[model samples]
Target: MTYCKVCSLGSDHPGIVVDEQRVCNVCRLDMVGDLLVNYRYTQEVFERFQHAGRNELGPYDCLFMYSGGKDSTYMLDKFTTEYGKRVLAWTFDVPFESTHAAENIRLAKERIPATFVVDADDDNIKKMMREVFNRPAPRKPGKYLDEKLPCVSCRTFFVIRAILHAHRNRIPYIALCADPQQILTMESNVREIVRGFYTTFGVGLTDELFRGEIEGLLFAEDDELPEIVFPFIAMRHTYDPDAIVAELKAKGLYASSPMETHCTLFPLLNYYSFTHWDCMFYKLNASSHVRAVKRNGGDGARSTFSLKFPGTLDVLEVEGRLKKVTLRIAKGEGTPQEHEAELVAAFRDLGTTETAARFVARSFLDMPAVAADMGIRLS
Candidate 1:
């Protein structure tokens, strides 16, 4: 029962069977080179993509998902100063966002003076996160179980809330402040967008998550909203992340004081994405010169699920989180050494025992290729 990973279709689907196991429809439809070939845009069409997106105005122009990070600050600057569009900045504060991130958001509110909204239910959110991580998932399926893949569940929740917020507010476009390197313009299509959503652990689309019942009950009575647009798809080519930061800083848009991501899990989750996607692929390719530096002896690897680099966190935080749930589930909180032994035993049961033993061989080798293949990377 070999299945094709690409389309998630099986050999039963019409396709040229590859290795007599699985075959992708797209691959069957065309030869390897045919699919891989890139079409050069014409001079006019290429030039068409050069300009900023059309200035579309309605009751409200856009909704900016502001994390008060340097990137989002720059985006807010561009939307207000450069484009002169009235935008709504929406911030989602999950239970786990760091203290610094919260400060950053407050700073943005003071400086920007834009209409801002914050949505969160702290205790419930934390319970959900704990449940998500503590619930045992099989290592074989490889859904979102990369070792120490921090805060994935929370991020997904925030995105869903953001989407619902945008729709209810009647905002036409949603700006993520995501750099060009994080996601590409071609990936803006519906299918790629959905795939990206899944890769980021947004498994339940809103249509299902809400179950056809709007929570607020007010939005259901209001205007009809169908879709939300990612303005980064158009702006990525025009704006630079570093330059955006610099320009905003010049306008007294300093980094926020109570800054944190939308999730408590970012400090750990970002470790993989920042290194692999940003530093290794994007920076090395010269897409952007944001050199990722692991200043505090951190993991310089990337996340396979949502390819991005990691971020700063106290070593105690990382060790504490990893040893808290994974070890506790394995050892029942006996002792530090006992927890380590139990974790090793659990990994062995999952056929990752060798890698766990190697981690014991070297203190910092906690995550190995087996776990890396699950999504984490160590290099």
Candidate 2:
């Protein structure tokens, strides 16, 4: 006697049903479904420069957000070597970033001496990581769709840093490695981008979380601001993943770490998103079905294989994640929701707050030191 919640039907829908829930087939459209139906951008409009020569190149024109990951490396190749832009590649190193991430940066440097700007405070990162895990909260809806869910924080930091760096360094534009699908989800317009700066981290999030680590970073109006570009958006549909990976490797531009592992924080975040399944670390197995589930929610953490990891989930790791969740919930940072008891218990037992607080304080202190090292003036 189940009735559809979306369309209010009884057992007669034409499409494959979901979760045996009474949700109507019409209303069951996930984010990807909506994207395909409503937001698919025309490729031609974005590919205006596809056939152009090196004539468009400008001095100190754009900044590329490089993470030394596969996608980013390919984007760098497309822009600098192919498009012939005077590009400055900027890398922001966050807390809990793996050693492999650092190595990848080194590899990117060998291929192209891009301007690498790293903002890393291990103690601060560890602390925030702890807080993020301790809390019980619902993340932004868009987070689940991102290739790397934990990137919400890291991405915000880089964008803010990039905008500020671009302003101070006189770089006229910022080039994102994000594809069309990603940017569209974040809102493609410049106005949306500015608003996103606030919304993405959850409304009213202060720079003081990291102790005013981002005091001077703010967006300027279009009339007063520099340009920000996304050269990859147009190529999202046309680019072949295999071809790009091969090309980068041939150029000796492969990331220094294992090709499959890019962002280290992914495993932790994925654990919660796919809670029914095993932790992200376990899902990293070559045969693991994480990627498939990510593309389509089928078998989406429903299988027993996904359930096995919780038993082995480390107390500290759970604490760290819960702490982060608590902070986001407390701050009303990204998304909104009710607090969960299990998450609170984990955080309370781990002494993560003390750790995270110390990290925040340290990060605040490190800002001036980093600015001095980079020879950038702080107001």
Candidate 3:
């Protein structure tokens, strides 16, 4: 049960390799030469694009994705004030968004000078999620599902929708405020990948719906495409969540801490991932937090990073309950139905509808086999 002294990755965690010095492979990689050189290149490219975008004759310099969470709110402010860009702050109003996030959007609208837009295509979004959940499990489900298909697919929806808006409106750049770890390079083949996602996962969608919205847009010429930029990575911003919240509050911009704001389905997703894969989606970010703390000359031991649940769930309490459930299942101390009933109850308590909670609880029928594929034993 040894753990990395730096990132705190336990030896039992899937695929984790800790050396004798009690440091995990991820932490060790950080010590190697020039880890962020690619990010530096991305920053340079972003600056060039920003300059070009400003010089262009367009109504908006960037279509900033404003989730009203701490990071997005801070980045929205920075884009408007620090960068002095003519920003179009766009919020994709997903049905599962936290109530507090909605309030934050209202506050940001009053404080920020950007032109704000909320696109609430609730029906389509719900339809997409239902398709994602109802799709047959892949034959060889791997750790990829641990990332949560619903979350990833929904974000893909956001990206596609943003691209459509920016392209049609002739916005030169589309800005996203994803943290450094989540920042992905918009490579030349991105459109192909995006297209493949639709063809594969979006099979349930009608041809008319696909052709009307995605087909031609995805095939647009590279020159005509809006340049996608990640502001946090471009600026090499050190992401301190606590500082971000404080800064937003100082500006009279109402913002909730990460734990207090997210999609309502996040707790159920976390429970699903943890129960099946023995890991949470935030595991990678937790390690990143430790590295950031040590880089800033602070003790990694003192870092406050931990498994987080979205919305109003008390993280420590949830962790305790999850551990107990894990123990009971591993020891064969509870029947499968009893264990599922308990999880469904927990999800319901966390604000998910009882039907949705039960659906998630039952969704694990095939997960034991998937877990075995990844060399994880599920009891």
Top model number, lDDT: 3
| Pairwise TM-score winner, candidates 1 and 3 | 3
For candidate 2, the 10 contiguous residues with the lowest summed lDDT are 302-311
Candidate 3, which segments miss by more than 4 Å at Cα?
Answer: 1-41, 53-57, 134-145, 184-193, 199-212, 234-237, 290-298, 301-320, 323-379
In the range 1-379, model 1's lDDT, one tens digit per residue, is: 3444432332322222434545444334443343223112122222333343543434556667787666677667667767666777888765445454566677777877577877775654554444444444323323212322344345555655665666666664566655443433223222333344455434454334444433343334333432334444455346444455456567777553211222334323433323322111121111112122232234433321112323332222333344343423222334546556654543333223365333432221222322332332233
lDDT of 1 at 80: 72
- lDDT, model 3: 0.63
TM-scores of all predicted structures: 0.49, 0.55, 0.70
Ranking of candidates on TM-score, top first? 3, 2, 1
- Local accuracy of candidate 3 as per-residue lDDT tens digits, 1-379: 6667876665545556678999887677742334355465557657766677362657788889899887888889888888888999998998777777888999999988999998777666666666655444433224323346667777777777787788788886778776665553232133654675666565457333344666666678887777677777753444555577778899888655554566666544554455544555455555565565667666433323212223333433444465565456544576778868876766565445566566545543333433333333333
Error of 1 at 48 (Å): 12
**Residue runs of model 2 more than 4 Å from their true location after superposition:** 1-59, 121-128, 137-149, 187-205, 209-219, 255-259, 275-379
Error of 2 at 49 (Å): 8.6
Q: Which residue pairs in candidate 3 have backbone atoms (N, alpha carbon, C) closer than 3 angstroms, thus clashing?
A: none
lDDT rank order: 3, 2, 1
